[model samples]
Target: MIILQANQLSKAYGAETILSSIKMEIKHRDRVAVVGRNGAGKSTLLKMIAGELPHDGGELIIPNAVSVGYLPQQAVLSSDKSIWDEMLDEFSDLLAIEQRIRLLETKMGSEETLSNEASYNKIMKEYDTLRADFEARNGYQLEADIRGILSGLQFNGFDYYHTTVSSLSGGQKTRLALGKLLLTKPDLLILDEPTNHLDIDTLTWLEGYLQGYPGALLLVSHDRYFLDKIVNQVYEISRTHSQRFSGNYSYYQEQKALQYERDLKEFEKQQSEKHKLEDFVQRNIARASTTKRAQSRQKQLERRDWMDRPDGLEKSVAFTFPTDQVSGHDVLRVRDVTLQYDDQKEPLFPSSSFHIDRGERTALVGPNGVGKTTLLHMLRGQMPPSTGSFQLGSNITLGFYDQEQAQLRSTKTVLQELWDRYPSFDEKDIRTVLGNFLFSGDDCLKIVNTLSGGEKARLALAILMLKKANVLLLDEPTNHLDIDAKEVLEAALSHFSGTILFVSHDRYFMNQIATKVLELLPSGLTTYLGDYDYYLRKKEEEKERLALDALEQPKTDQEDGAQNESKESFEQQKDAKRKKRQQERRMAEIEELMQQTENEINALETALLQPETYEDHEKAHDVQLALQQANQTLEDLLVEWDECSTDNA
Candidate 1:
């Protein structure tokens, strides 16, 4: 069914037109992506479609029962509630049903209810209906569902559930907000730049989740790889007009290129014919015999309709990394380098070792908080590693591109920003570089503080290019760049002769520029001598091998020990076996106890909610005490179980 359809949808801000005429349709479970440049009105169109921003003209149709969930660029969630509680709010109706069922259970068990057939029947009927509704909605797995979403959003630790929304960072809050929205399961999910803060791992996870989602998805994101994986249809908003493409990002690019080429050729052909006609008219108009023919040609030329030139690709940033000097063959080397945080029980990086050769574009990748950027910082001499050492080879000059563009002087103008980097250069030369980076004319006078993220990124690139450093360390270099700018940057980096040790979650960039992949893990660094796709394939193969190896493990009993050995050795082995067996037994015991404790806590909670228990202080207190003890016991069991499992591993 068509959940939404827009015909000639128009939106504007006073005299300025944003979306003049937009047309698109979203059917059941349609994966649609809205793509455009930074200021191309993509967001405005989405806002209009979502009804967050009013439309000035045209029609948008949404079915009465079709629910929509919109996530703006910044998911602003203001709440004092804990993360888990805030998520629980999404299922308030199901929770209400649960409460009603509990009340019915309490009433049905009463002597008065048992003595009255009509009252008992009515309560039982209500309870049956509520229970069926709850079951239909998967109410029995409420906690499990919530846990799955939280973990997928990287809120895995037990304590994260209790962390209030106000305490979370903006990015973390955005993640939490996304998780809460998933729980709501709206019919249509519209997201703006949903992949902004997601790392490669989280991006893949979300991609998988959305692929399996039953609802339609309409999202705007500059992440091309993300768009390629999730979207089947693309709506492009350009020059205040909308065009729909019936394919993913890659397919759209191909079609757009082909169409442009066709239009260009047609225009050139017509111009050639017109030029021939003009030349003939000029040559023959003076001759007496050919005067009629020349006049006829001139009249034909005047009557013919002319086609305007088709627009080409947008002007993108164009600059290359010019190395000042040659570097040694070994650009950088590290041995046993890692960091151990005081708060973390395990070191974030465990004796990780890797090296980058001269001219190698090494792409460093890992999950969030796995210290990819921190490792780059250590290499840049911003800080020392917790242990081990890393060294740069002979005559290596490093240039760093921070994702935040923190190195740029916000007080300076865009023109001054580049000029300040190279004092001896001619002013024209500096301006030329800035102009190549899309800071032409009056744009160069804009203050850095007022520049957008993409503008700041361009300014930073201009400086990095002028620095002429032989080795570059980039952290999320594509952070604020749109798809076009990212492609330009990727091409520039690909052509650079110097070694590149950069961290990026842009999988498309990784695949485009990476000659090698360094996967930073808790255990150590794993090197894949290929692009992102090769790394993924190898990872899957490794996973399958590990699964098979796990199943092939040999099992032995206490009787399988060596029959004859030195007493010391025999006794030590026997004691170790006995301890292992005891730990295993304790694990089984804890599992049983945890289940019992959960049942006890539920029963106690139900009793505490009853009228008889709450009306009497002594009974209420006793039940509450029992519930507390049960909860504490469950917590203890979980900790012990985790330890025993770790020991076994």
Candidate 2:
């Protein structure tokens, strides 16, 4: 069924057109992605479809019966209700139905109603209908559904029953909003920048969930990996026009390039023929013998329609990081480093050690609030580690790109921001650099504070390019960049001779530029000697190996017992065996407790590391104390397990 259709849908802000006669359609279960550079009106188009904004012209058709849900980039949930209650609100009608069914049951069981066969039957029928409706809606599994979605969106670690909606971080609120939207199960779901705040694990789970979603999905995102995984159809919105491609983002890229090439060739051929006809008419129109032929050619030219040349390639920021000198073989070495925020709660990672070699691009990946940014800060000496140290190799010069763009002077103009730093450079040279970054003419005169996020990112990269450092430390460098800018940065970094240690949630960017993957867990860091895809494959293989090991463990134990049965007398062996079994059970229980304690400590540590907690002295202190207690319990459990094993032996 066609859930939505927009024919020549046009939206404009006063005189400025945002969307120009755009056509799009969404059928049942269609997965469509809207992609373009920043300021290409992708979000505006979504808002128009969502009915949050009025279109200036054209028609948008959505079936009256078809339900639609829209999630914007920044969705604020202003409620005093707890997370679980807020989610339950999505099913208020079902809950009301359930209550009605209970009331009907009460009426049927009353002696007054039961005495009358007609009334009893009527009440029972109502109850049955309500029950059927509830079951059809899967009302009994409501809590399970909530839990599943919360877990998929990485909210399992949260205390849903106690945590109020107002207390959540912006990202957490966005996730909760998404969970609520998913539970509504509208016929058409539209999401804008849905992957903005999601970590890799959550992104992976969301991709799978959306892939199997029953409703049609219309998404606007800069995440290429996500688009490639979840979207089957891609709509490229450029210059206020929309072009549809019947495939994933990768397929769209390939097909778009091919289409452009074909159009360009065709356009050139038409231009060539037109030029030849015009030349012949000009040379022969004056001659009496060929005048008739010239007139015929002129008439043919008037009758012919010429093809307009295909649009020139869209303007994109050009990026390159060239170093005048190469770093030593060992670019960076981190030894037993532990990052801790003020008030000194739990460490980010427990005594993690890793190294980056010269010319190697290592991607630092982890869940949000896992201190990926802190680690970069420590590496660059912007922040000190609570424990241990890191060192740069000899002759290595470091360049840092802050995702926040905090290094840029807000008081200075865009041109001055670069020129002030490099005073020796001529005005033309500075303009040349700015032009390459897509800032030209009056654009360079804009103050740094007035620039958009994308512009700031470009300026930062332009500055980084001029630094010519041998070692680069980047914190979410692709955060504000559009798809084209990201691709440009990826290409530049791929060819960069310098070593790179960067943190990013963009899996596609990592796949393109990273030679190695560093996964930071609460336990420590694990290095995967390959790109994002390779790392994912290895992680799956590891899970399978562990599963198989677990399945064979009991059999291995039984075999060992069987082989030892004949080696001893019945009574003595039986006594020892019983003691051994008891010890083993105790050890297992202690080990489980130890693991739980460690997890609790890690969770507390993560909580303390959050900006809100660290900023509050009392909260940080309480969490720090809890973390210490958890650590003590874990230590005692380990000692008890060791003693038990010794006694059994």
Candidate 3:
């Protein structure tokens, strides 16, 4: 069924029209991803469909009795209610039905001449129907279902009973709202950037849940991976128009390119034909004998359906920064670092040691709250380490770009902002830089407050370019950028010879730009000489080994009892002279081994990057073999250490 349909939909804010002549049909069971760059009317479309906003010029037809649930980009929940009560409210309809059924059951059991046969029969019939409906909808297991959904979304072991909505963090509130929407089981689900704050595990669960959802889904998200995993179709709002793609995001990209090529070819053919017809008509129009032919040609020209030329990324700014002076050999150095926020109880990364060589592109990776941003702040000199010290080499200036660009002035226009930041830059230079970043003539007049997330990111990046710093520290630099803008940034980073230390969750972006990956774990920070994908594979191997060892550990009563005694003894003698000597020797050997492997891996990477070596089959094969061995050895060592620790425990 056509669950939702829009015709001639147009929305305007003041004189600026965000959407014009938007038409779309949302069918039942269709999973559509509404995609566009930031500030591309995606949220506005959802609001219109949800009846939260009126369309200025459009006809909207929604089927009667069809329910629609909308989860906006930002959602607020009632503060007085606990998480448990918030979810329970989704089933208000079911609760009402249950009340009626209960009342009927009570009457059926009463006296009044054995309940009058006909009335009793009617009551029983209604009860049976309601019961079946309830069962079909999984009503009886509503609490369990709600609990499962919440748990899957990483609310496991949480005290939802006491945790009120207002007490929950922003991410928690969003999850709570998501749980409610799932329980409501509406005919249409509209979600905006639902995966913005979700962790990998939670996102995976959401993908599975949405896959089995029986209703239509309209989701707007910048998470390409999530959209590709969940959505079957893509609705792209572009350049004052909306285009539909018949397949997943990856397929849409492929098809879009193919369609563009086909259109260009067709247009070329039509233009060629038109030119020939025009030539024939112009030459024969004055000849009496050929007047009929000229008239026929003119008619053909008037009747022809000329093809419109394909336009590419509309008004996309082309930006590139001038290179800066070379930095010292040692760009940044940290020794035995230990950082702790005043408000945080735990240290971010203690006993951490790292060195950033000039022109090395590194990606800092970890789960949320694992100190990715904290580490960046420490590097930028905005925050000091609790213990130890860090140094920036002489002549190595830093360009720091926080997710929330702190330097932006809300009251300043784009030009004024640029000028204020870089007084040395002439107007021509400023315009050129802005143009490269996609900010054009009148766009330069836009106030900071009016700019979208992508625009802000772009503007911040432009400012970074003007600084001409030899070292750049970025935290979630791609957080607010669309795919196109991300591509632009990636291109800039790829060409940039300066040292870069970035924290980003975008795996694709990391793969393209990261020359090395640093993983921050509870134990310490470990640097791997490769991109994010390489690190992921090694991490997975280590995880699987740990899981396998955990499964195979001795758990019998006799084994447990023996281990308990041994553990006690071991702890008691942990500080003894002999034990301390043994521990130090083993630790020294492990450290030495890690360093040796790192050296070997670095050599192999250097060779792999060489054009001549990569082209040679034998040399490339050798490099690959050496890299695999080094990575495998590192993973094996980690697993072995984990296993020994578990056994000792």
Best-matching candidate per TM-score:
2
- lDDT of candidate 1 over 185-224, digit per residue (tens): 7899999988877877788889879976889999999889
Looking at model 2, report the run of 10 residues with the lowest lDDT sum: 562-571
Q: What's model 2's lDDT at 460? A: 93
Clashing pairs in 1: none
TM match of model 2 to true structure: 0.84
Per-residue lDDT tens digits for candidate 3, residues 517-551, read 98876579999999877987888678757755654
For all candidates, the clash counts are 0, 0, 3
Q: After superposition, how far is residue 45 of candidate 3 from its true place, in Å?
A: 1.6
lDDT of 2 at 209: 90
- Model 3 gets an lDDT of 0.81
lDDT, candidate 2, 313-341, per-residue tens? 69999868999887789988889889888
Per-model TM against the reference: 0.81, 0.84, 0.77
Q: How close to the true structure is residue 634 of candidate 2, measured as C-alpha lDDT?
A: 89
What lDDT would each prediction earn against the true structure? 0.86, 0.88, 0.81
Please give the lDDT score at residue 508 for candidate 2: 92
Candidates sorted on TM-score, descending: 2, 1, 3
